[model samples]
Target chain A: GESVGLHLPTLSVQEGDNSIINCAYSNSASDYFIWYKQESGKGPQFIIDIRSNMDKRQGQRVTVLLNKTVKHLSLQIAATQPGDSAVYFCAEKDAGNMLTFGGGTRLMVKP
Target chain B: DAGITQSPRYKITETGRQVTLMCHQTWSHSYMFWYRQDLGHGLRLIYYSAAADITDKGEVPDGYVVSRSKTENFPLTLESATRSQTSVYFCASAVKETQYFGPGTRLLVL
Candidate 1:
């Protein structure tokens, strides 16, 4: 069994500011991690991902950092905009199984 | 109209009634998953299919059943709906590592 938890359930950032959302997982066997953003009335959309062997991966204005040693994963969003206000989730993929997502953190960008 | 699409964007049902949520993808991905999101929390996988006719249970599969007869379609069924089953159900498809999700189906069980 694996448990993924978010350090912050909610985060607020001013427009143009950067936002960081953190996630902690309990599975040491997990080899893949991903970050997803879910807007209101929409499903989670892939943001970025990092493999166990890699520590970081960047996509657009988002960067995902994977700390396998600490079982920690974080998603950093640069130049936060009002459109970036959404819920972010970090998921861990075990071996070849489906992903298990964390509780999720709500990111709010104030204009 | 492309990628993934969920049917009946919103649904309402009574307890003990049976309801089915449909999910379809045009990506022809190898994996299709069903997940339920409650409140503002993260999604909990309900079931997933690795390929046609090959399915497996996920984190929360109780009272929920799923079937994937084709590579593009995965349907979730709640034999007897309960209030606790009310949530937004999302269907996703993955080819390799990354997954893509459909809009989602909002289900309410009275």
Candidate 2:
């Protein structure tokens, strides 16, 4: 079965430093990819997304990079903060509009 | 305005009992999705509806049933609940690229 996976289950970063979370997907047919941040006791929130055609897309303080050649995806957060700590998940949507999600990476910010 | 709301934020039921999770959205989005989140499995889609009266099975839909009689409502029903069905279920709606998620319903089957 095709699945999306992350390299690390948990990542700890300094509050002022930058953070990067990596994900790998198996299905090449997936054309759209999105990054979501899920806070405790809340639902997942959309952060940013990147299409298969583009390599990267930037948001306010977050950026999503998609490497189609390796079926890799990454989320970069600049100037990480305590509130930014949460479970991050990468999702891929094929042409059918069906989305497959990764296991999720827990981001912990150290003060 | 409430973007999306799920009823019975938490539920507990015994095996063989039936349970239904309600999802409602006010955005009038064309697409609605139901996903279950477990420890090992992050989020697996159970079902989705592209529009009213148009629903399709997703990755994990064997023990679940869904119906979208109206565009604003998409409910998931477990005819005979099992212990394995215990998990956090989230309802989401997508306009085009971005998806908005509801708070989620926590179900515990014993």
Q: For candidate 2, what's the TM-score of chain A, rounded to 2 decimals? A: 0.98
Query: What tens digits encode model 2's per-residue C-alpha lDDT throughout B1-110?
Result: 99999988999999999899999999999999999999887888899999999999888899899999999999999999999999999999998967899999999999
Best by TM-score: 2
Which residue pairs show collisions in model 1? Answer: none
- iRMS (Å) per candidate: 1.7, 1.0
Tens-place lDDT digits, model 1, residues A41-83? 8889888888899989889998888888888899999999999
CAPRI class assigned to model 2: medium
Off by over 4 Å in 2: none
Q: Give the clash count for model 1.
A: 0
DockQ numbers for every candidate?
A: 0.70, 0.79
Model 1 residue B100 CA deviation (Å) reads 1.2
